[model samples]
Target: MKKVILRTVFISLLIFSCKRKQVDIPIFSYSILNDSVKNFKLNVNEKEPIIHYEYFHQKDTIKRLFFKYNSDKDLLISNLDTFYFNKKTYNSKSLQFKFYQKKEINSHKRFLVFNKNYGLLANLAYGSDYLFLKDSISEMDKKLLFKALFYDLNKIETD
Candidate 1:
């Protein structure tokens, strides 16, 4: 009876003490992304709308972002990038976001994505772009978000 209790306690401690491995999310960069993926093609096929375009050592998905917004009236094949810490503002608490602006030019197509995890609850594009940090991020943030997204679609790499 004493031996059984000791063994059970030992096993419980071992199980509870072990930590599970966590998947690492890599920082967003143009180099880490695939230059030639079509959002629509992959979005319709996946069980979930989100797709993992970024890989770590080709081993596993490092990070994922909201990849598809399927509104016909609004921007089609549109995606959102992750919020980044605002370095210019010198505020570590402040975050800045980038949006993927998709376009068709001369019948050629390209997909450019760079984002961190954005919650659907706040995605108003799908009637879910809620105010993530309602107190910290205000209506002004939306204006800034649009301005950044409105920039030129893609600046091809000459190198």
Candidate 2:
């Protein structure tokens, strides 16, 4: 009986010690896409250039930001005031703001793609004239704007 109790105590202490040593992981990545020339493509029906921003979070803190571009572009832009607490519950912590803007040429077409894991958020296409003249932005201009926006978002620090 004493030997069994000693074994139980030792096991309890081992579990408790392990739990205490568990570290809090932070989510560290965040990005914004803002480039028009290199990050944008025109006249290809099958190819579309994409801008990406990645964020990694553990223990509810930002830890890293990775940005890239790909042919299968997946982008998400959100200004949600609260984040989902669970799969259903909502928790308000702070406000978030992000703006996406793009424009192309007069004869070409431009598309804005956004994804939210479960479904598509936005997949907008516009004619070149409307994108350029109406929006007062060229393809080159669009790239510059996106680059600027991405850099601005990168400057934000989440603690």
Top lDDT hit = 1
Which ten contiguous residues of candidate 1 have the minimum total lDDT?
A: 37-46
65-124 per-residue lDDT for model 1 (tens digits): 433433222222333333322211111134433333334333432323233332121222
Counted clashes in each candidate structure: 10, 20
Native-to-model Cα distance after best TM-score fit, residue 32 in candidate 1, in Å: 28
lDDT (Cα, 0-100) at 73 in candidate 2:
32
**Which candidate should be chosen as best, given TM-score against the real structure?**
1
Q: Write the per-residue lDDT of candidate 2 for residues 116-143, one digit (tens) a residue.
A: 2211112222322111111234556555
Which whole-number lDDT from 0 to 100 does residue 26 have in model 1?
A: 32
